[model samples]
Target: MNQRVLSGSDLAERARRAIPGGVNSGQRSIPGLTDLVITEADGARFRDADGREYVDYHAAFGPPLLGHNDPDVSAAVAEAGRTVDLCGVGVTTAEVELAEALVELVPSVEKVLLTSTGSEATFHALRVARAATGRRLVVKFQGCYHGWHDAVSLNVISAPERVGARDPISAGILPEVLEATLVLRFNDAEGVRAAFAEYGRDIAAVIVEPVPHNVGCLLPEREFLRTLRDECTRAGSVLIFDEVISGFRHDLGGWQAISGITPDLTTMGKAIANGYPVGALGGRADLMELFSSRPGGSVFFAGTYNGHPAVVAAALATLRKIRTEPVHEHVFRLGDRIRTGLSEVFAGLGLPAVVTGYGSVFVAYFMTGPARTYDDLLRNDASMFVGYRRRLLGHGVFELPLNLKRSHVSYAHTETDVDRLLEAAAAAARAQLADGDVLADVADASTMGGVADRC
Candidate 1:
């Protein structure tokens, strides 16, 4: 592989003049990297602006489950573009077909409402819950990121001390918006019971990620999940499973199918379209009908690009491929292999870290044991993990910039890629251990902004 002599820093400098923070998303900007500009991606690898190729585990923040630029999905999008570019006035056949596919595949989805992004899906789902239950408060577990909407955006990455407090991560979020949201510790059945006991009647919905990946992949205990379902049913509140990241990636029916705990409303995106900008809100027909543009019902759900032809076609192709192929099997096998290999590598290096996740998504926590809640994750040596991630990047393993974000294995990934990742992890661990004062060095690096602060 010949490297091209392109300058990523030069391109980033130019982008900073035009865009805020020189990136479209805040997480794209790494602390120590000169430039994080990706030029091309195919299968399991992506090429940077400098023409450096690396095995990508970021998966474009969990969208490219089939890997970037999959041939079938691209071909479907191209064919749809030739037929119809945009039909804003009327619904297209592609949209109709995609909705049918979603209804057939997802367990709780009886009626599907299309949206342009995950944020829109979550926002509308919350609204529908509010309308159905006639309540204003929403209960969200801490560390589970539904999206960047005002209602779900609060307390995403709050400090350990602010677990139950309504602390908004970003500025400009109104206090009233934060008040509507009740942040609870994940896997805390007692806390959930207490919240419902205090404000059960006023709660519109209880939204959760069945397998929370936002704060490094914490799986819910069976008791905790059942408690949410029981509590919501008792309180007449809608249970919204924000499966934006876990949907279709774990199974055809999402994690709900595996758990047999179907939510009243399900918000799905990311892997649903295999990198296309698409989202869906679906659940019990009675609840979903709140968003209907019919005579009596009114929820006000509208988006111009809700089901753009090309995007729908891409989603259709991706879903059909997953249905017929061994996609889940391949991803699961790779995930197990990677986890085992990484565990062995860390144990051999005498590093106190644990790999946590389910199915194809995983994260390396610089802690001795598994984390059950957001505060438990805060106990991790995040600075040390950031240094480890940077070292892996140097060795051609491109993980997401955030230390706590989950890394995914796409169907395109192979055993060879897993081996390469293990090799890089071993090398990185050796380099970190070479210094006697590694913890002190990591603490110093933490002072530099843009290092393991954001979720």
Candidate 2:
């Protein structure tokens, strides 16, 4: 028998026949940036199946905080493979150790529960809130994305027509579930107040992404977050900070540490495991005890793969490195470099754009002024956003071309990498802005048409 070496395009074609839209996640099916089959990832770069290398600012949508294939995390996972696999009945020691760390580090987490994905963490958090308070309503900001759960999978990156309306991002969700969720604008303190005034007693939780990273980083207004705390406290509604993206990426304590505002519950994932699949929900011990497995329990919370040994080991290693090493200091410096560099690039070219983000995350918006809400981001040129990102791929920088998406910086990146990105950005912006095409001239993505092998 002869071995078959498949091209990236050939693999993508094979996937399209099997997977919906040739991708597992909707965001991966980019119009001009799909078809890459990643063969390897290490440090700050990734290589496509065909061996084309690119500096990876995509960072697997902000999961690779320590950078792709971090040595510490990889080694831990390898060791775990030799030790334990899965025993669903009992919890793993690694899980207990991770929970202890979460409680110690995250300001609001007195106790914690492990899960396999961000979505599951969020779903469980909302359930806890509803069960604890006996309320039916959940208040979610428009631009923030907690997860794909029915209550949240709406209004994110919504079309202009759907703004300010109860628009479900997906159909088939029970109408009552949509009604239970009150959609409000990010940084809209008045909206929070009004919602509380109308349905305070019925609202179970006010879920937010302290920094709305999903729509390219709409930094939260301190007053708005404070207002949420005050309203939720007065109404006895649980305040849930969905820190899936901003959790371990920002600080060991999550954004709650830097913000100086505590939530009743916190959901964390993404960088917690340095790209390993693990999520955690943590909060006051009194509330977390509502899980079916606990004393005086009622709410059901179970996952067959929760706290799988290898991923738990990865999380433990990632946390230990964050505690002992200069991970945050390094990545923060690089984040500032990229954001400032991008700002300078656009300003020098006399282009109107806004660059915004907190530590280790940056988004270059193709519009004038700042973006603190979904409404402000709508002013951005969606076409130019996609086209500029597409052009950068030609320069060997991997940024997903989806509009309102942010680029990440990791400890693996260097000042030289920032310089290269700026140089690439200058060239891409000059050509893209001058041509003024509706992304018509953007370079083609990989030679394939389906899924990207992002490992």
Candidate 3:
């Protein structure tokens, strides 16, 4: 552990005594306790309790596109708090403002339903789909994570034996629930078609991450997205694009605008509120009509914190900045610079890497070429990635802690930030390449290996 990061060691120690994993979120808890204890964050930098600062490429796990604590969003939240922050039984102006802004910002969305987190938004979306279509089955692709709800959590990560098959990754999710989920390989149009042909009539919805970013930032085939839209419409089932990570990231309208396809339902979170706990499900009017139907017909979606006014104000402010201002374009331009810099660094090191992204979001994958599916990402050498992460952290560059996910750049990052990140990356890559070679030699020497089990 770095001595500079030790100021929060006591805080973590106390947290472990109460929380299950010494942290509220799994991703927040670094695997080896190497992360700084973030005391405060503003713009593209976060400070530890000991006052150590680093360039934050994770961007609070792909939110804060306007950077942390943007004055407009914070002021909006603060002003709204002076009136009312939550209205469990009544609607507030903040909610209406947010809904209006979202509808205006996202092209395919006509109506909006708000929630506190991505998981709740997805759960409500699934329930709304089932109620609207009069079906029980939900189809999802492998490695597309739509939060932790039981219905969409299947096939998130499979064991090697279950790699190419559909299997639930957790217990307590009944077999019947798993039975209702049809999982297929991502980017495989034929598999998608076959599943629809067999069970489309019973499927309530086809839910997916337009960009499958859970395992890695794997882009969907253009034709596959179009086919999904066509099939869901033809089958009379709702199509859900879970754009929690992709919404307002690549473009203002999300991957839908980029892919030129429209879904019946779209779930967005993460970046919408710029790190505030807010999420939304929005789309076609007829599909959303299920939520307000008759007593027996209406999908029973209720939450104490759904459309919390403070968060709504933040989201409204954030979306307005993206739409009315040049923040999104700035983020895109900076994202290009970062990606180009990463490509040059990786290529110069003779490392197989590809930096792929559209606007603020991108991934530096250590592979020979682009990864189009979760299956392809599964084939990547994660050990090499872990080594790279460790080396980068040592050099004062804070990237996403997971090899399964990559870092993000925000509008707050400057050209100087990009240069510093590239320098850190080049140094990390070189050191990791040497470590990788040494590990390969050690593996060759050991006689007792069938496979290395890494979780």
Candidate 4:
């Protein structure tokens, strides 16, 4: 593999002038780009701009469940690209096949609507929910991000000071958009019930991540999921499960399958198309009917690349690979191995860190206790965990630099890859402990400023 000729910093400087924030996405902009510029990836490793080889846990930010440049998907995409440049507005055989496959595999979804990104799927889901229920308010949990859309982006992660109160994280989001959305605590049944009691009549939908991975892979209580289903039904509020990060990572059907509760609407992305830019929204027939574009309902949804043949081909191939090869079981076993290794490594160092996750995704929280809610995450030593991310990169393991956020273990990761991660993690922990200062002391307390220069 060939590395970029320019250093990471020089490349970033060049990119910043051409692109926003010196990166294409928010997560791609780490503290500094001086050391990282990905050129090529194969199996579990990525070659940086400097041609440094790294065992990658980034996994293209959680879409490469089948690994980067998977032969099956690449071949499928290539064949499809040769057949058609763009499907455009017309129907295609590939789109129908992909939708049919999704309907057959995912128990709750009867129909599917495709989009170019996770944001579009979520945005459409909210529109469907509002149209179906004829209500105005939408409920979401704090710290669980659906997308950058105005409706889904409100108070995604309130700072520690705004723990119990609602506060929008971004500016230019209309006050009306924030008011229309009701932000609540994650994993709280009482809060759900109380909100329903107060705003049930006006509530259009309750969208929740079945496993809540955006805030450090927080697991939902079984009863809480049941409560969401029952309460939404009783109150005539549509239930939506946002499975952007969890879809096909654990079970092929997603977290909702393990929860045993059906939602009115479901949004899926990330792992759906094996790293291609695609997403899907689907569920009950009655609610999906509102999107028919017939005379009556006005929930118009359209995208230029909604059912792109190249992306659809990739998705079909990825789904087929998951079914035939059955990578989920292997990834689960490997996930357990890595989690246990991190736990043991932290325990040996006498650090109060915990490795928590489900399926192939996990997070290392530098707190004494579990992170059940955003408040719990705020109390955790985020600075220390981020420092660990930086040190691990120096040792050739590339996980996200943010602490208490999503970490990945892809199908390409071997037992040796897990060993390398645990080794780097142990070393990172030792480095943090030797510094003697807690992450809270070492880090700036403000939320608006940029992260310190690292890596």
Report, for every candidate in turn, its global Cα lDDT versus the true structure: 0.83, 0.86, 0.77, 0.81
Query: How well does candidate 1 score on lDDT at residue 337?
Result: 85
Give stretches of model 3 more than 4 Å off.
1-6, 292-297, 437-455
- Candidate 2, residue 435: lDDT: 82
Per-residue alpha-carbon lDDT of candidate 1 for residues 1-455, written as tens digits (9 for 90 to 100)? 99766588888888899998898765667666637787888999999898789999988778888998999999999999888988577778888898898899888999998888888888999998898888999999878888777898776666666667886766798888888989888999999999999999999999998987877789889899999999999999999998988899998899999999989989998898899998889999998777755446788878888888888998999998998999999999999888888889998988988887887988888887768888788877766677777778889998764557779999899888998999999998788778535545544444222312111
In model 1, the Cα lDDT at residue 416 comes to 88
Off by over 4 Å in 2: 1-4, 441-455
* TM-scores, all models, native as reference: 0.95, 0.95, 0.91, 0.94
By the lDDT metric, which is better: model 2 or model 3?
2
How much does candidate 3 score in TM-score?
Answer: 0.91
List model 2 lDDT by residue over 299-405, tens digit each.
Answer: 99888888999989999999999899999999999888889889999999998999988989999988898687899988987767778888888899988777777
In candidate 4, which residue ranges exceed 4 Å CA deviation?
1-4, 292-297, 436-455
Top lDDT model: 2
Whole-model lDDT, model 4: 0.81
Q: What are the per-residue Cα lDDT tens digits for candidate 3 across 425-447?
A: 89988887876764343322221
Cα lDDT tens digits for candidate 4, 230-344 = 9999998999999888888878888888878888888888888889999999899777778854446578977888889999999999999999996998888899999998999
